[model samples]
Target: MFIKECAGYELEKEKSNTSEDFFNRSVVTFIDGSEEKTLHVLYVRYFDEFIQEFTPYQQDPILTKDNIQVTFKDIVALVCLIKNPGLRNRKRLYINSKPEFTSYFQDIDFDKLTDVVLSVKQNNKFELRSPLDYIIQTR
Candidate 1:
């Protein structure tokens, strides 16, 4: 399936005093068709039950007509496998891995996601499908 469009991001921070130290983000690329399928740049920061615990803390405040688009955390596990150039060129994750790298999604811009999609596809652990892939509902 072709990933027609994509987006995913996080605008959060810990209890910090000043905003300078706070974390910010930049957009990534949207889609591609180089070799293997390419998933967006969505990833997880933790493993184990920590994921379950870390979730409820996400922003859910319903204010000023905003959205709470969440990006699942497994995509990080998939990234860890793409560090090496050889593996990346091969388009597959062939090393010890975790189960969390199974499913995830988000609503980020193309800039912040393109590199990730390229890297992930380079390692071959993701499935880049078009939004229609789900909307169409094929068996």
Candidate 2:
């Protein structure tokens, strides 16, 4: 089910021009039969490349129920999930990195991260009434 949903998201991403439509995409999973958690894996692309480039170590792949190996991509995806966009917009937002992967992100330059996030936010803007308004007005 999760794999299928990921495939669907990939298809949508390929067909769309901007990621704004998927900015709020997330997955909810049950924990301990009584608890639930929401994961924003769809935002993994925001940190994928940067993490991959900076980290030389990799975690041992774990096989899922579907027999899929969860590799570095999955690790990065889990780490990058933005639980609260509202809180993230603030001047300082603390994110806890998993102990195993702490070294991978400990050296991140916040200024660069902020610039990247701001750039993504700026580029993703589109008029809600008409998605093509910017394109039309530019001509």
Candidate 3:
């Protein structure tokens, strides 16, 4: 499945704020080749904190929404290095190292999401590659 759309907004903060207060709320929608959809609401934060707690074997942290909690893993995908020429590029270190866990989707224009090429997760690795390469590799 590829990302069909991604939209987000910053959360409000009070005068007295902590590190946790700095985050954005995003909703990502995925569509498979057969047109099935999956939606995920993400609370986006700094990558440093997320990476510190990340481990492949451990269960991901639970997400709380409307008083309900759910545990889920972030989507792991490959983004085309050449798409979205108008948007600012992400840092090289963040491009291929980890999954799209923390800052990958931060501050991006949701409308331009469809202008870029995206690959669905077929495995646990992420890399900077052309969309065609991703499809060939997965096949």
Candidate 4:
């Protein structure tokens, strides 16, 4: 299942764009075998940002369930699920990578033995709706 994780939340693409339409727990597919899901294996797409954004989405039990179709509001509910602990060991932050390393979603990635930050200095910067960006705008 991990091998088939979606790469990221695909906004423009739509399986069922109609309001109140549900697309529970099914892998959104293309005509061919190649699929267009919103998750990526290793979660290495944009490590730090991915971590920050994905953290809130990971612990969501409803959003994480199998084949349950939902609407945009369901996505909001997913954000809410971040704080609710359905499991015995739920927490605000996943605990795997810390020095003690006792976090969930730690194994979400490929279970890489090493926690290395791969760097790629790029010329372009993607605009984001983050607190840092808001601060940069006001100042």
Candidate 5:
């Protein structure tokens, strides 16, 4: 079910130029009867090369999902996700890491996490609400 929706979304991408339109429209129902279809994985191709240059000496790396890896592209999307949770923020919660980190997203707690910024769409602009105020003006 998810695979088909993802495929459809990918196919629609070639026809639509609207940034917000590039998203999966299906919702997932959990065993607890909860429904959610939030932004999950972001595969950024442009920044793949930068992965080799990122040195994680400043702090311990984030705990990623088992068998899951964080690439440079993921980091780039994460940076954007933190800056503007609304940039194609079709997904309910995007960790750039994995969807299982619900605690991290709900708490908005960043003890040793780098590039951790909470953002939202305010007045049609990307308003940074943590660490510092990094205003991103959108057209």
Candidate 6:
């Protein structure tokens, strides 16, 4: 699904079913030829979860409407900035990382989530699909 077409995201969708063992696993190969299992980003389905995850301590009232769209690249970039410390750090935390655990998303345009860009594939294998593999155009 194109980022523009996405109405919103669901975080609970990232959960692993009891029957599925190998889910949301990707082998990312860097320029140096190193590859490893990488955990992709998750879609925040519930707005309350998004608020609680991103603004748990804040006293400010959130008024943003539901179904805010966000791109896959920005989500990954947000992960790199908020969650991962460095290259090795990213790989180490590749398995089952959550967006609510990150802090960078709070500082960026997450409030204006509709401006984000990325494509999502709605199959059993790739739901919150990344913009890699020529799936998304470079901005």
Best by lDDT: 3
Model 2 spans with C-alpha error above 4 angstroms: 1-11, 14-17, 20-33, 44-46, 57-68, 80-104, 107-139
lDDT of 6 by residue, 66-109 (tens): 44323332244333322332432354333334544444444444
Ranking by TM-score: 2, 6, 3, 5, 1, 4
Question: Which window of 10 residues has the lowest lDDT sum in candidate 3?
Answer: 85-94
Clashing pairs in 2: none
Q: Is candidate 3 or candidate 4 better by TM-score?
A: 3
How does candidate 5 fare on TM-score?
A: 0.26
What is the per-residue lDDT of model 1 for residues 1-139, given as tens digits with 9 covering 90 to 100?
2222223344365556544222212122222446433333323322322434423223322011123232333223222222221222332232212343322222222233433444443443334343332222335
Ten-residue region with minimum lDDT total, candidate 2: 1-10
| Tens-digit lDDT track of model 3 for 1-139 | 4454433444466566554355544433444444534343334345324633542223333333344322222322212222222122232211323354534433333222222322222221223233333222221
lDDT assessment of candidate 4: 0.22
Candidate 3 segments whose C-alpha is farther than 4 A from its true place: 13-21, 41-44, 47-139
Error of 6 at 55 (Å): 5.8
Tell me how far candidate 3 lies from the true structure as C-alpha RMSD in angstroms. Answer: 15.4
How would you encode candidate 4's per-residue C-alpha lDDT over 25-54 as one tens digit per residue?
Answer: 211111112322221111111223333343
Off by over 4 Å in 5: 1-37, 40-46, 51-70, 92-139
> Which segments of candidate 1 are over 4 A away from where they belong?
1-46, 51-68, 94-139
lDDT of 5 by residue, 29-136 (tens): 111113323344433222233332343323222323344432222233334344444433255433323233222233222332222211111111132334223222
> How far in Å is the alpha carbon of 22 misplaced in model 6?
14
Of 1 and 5, the candidate ranking higher by lDDT: 1
Give me the runs in candidate 6 sitting further than 4 Å from their true place.
Answer: 1-48, 52-77, 80-89, 92-104, 111-139
Candidate 4 weakest lDDT stretch, 10 residues: 112-121
Residue pairs clashing, model 5: 38-91, 38-92, 39-91, 39-92
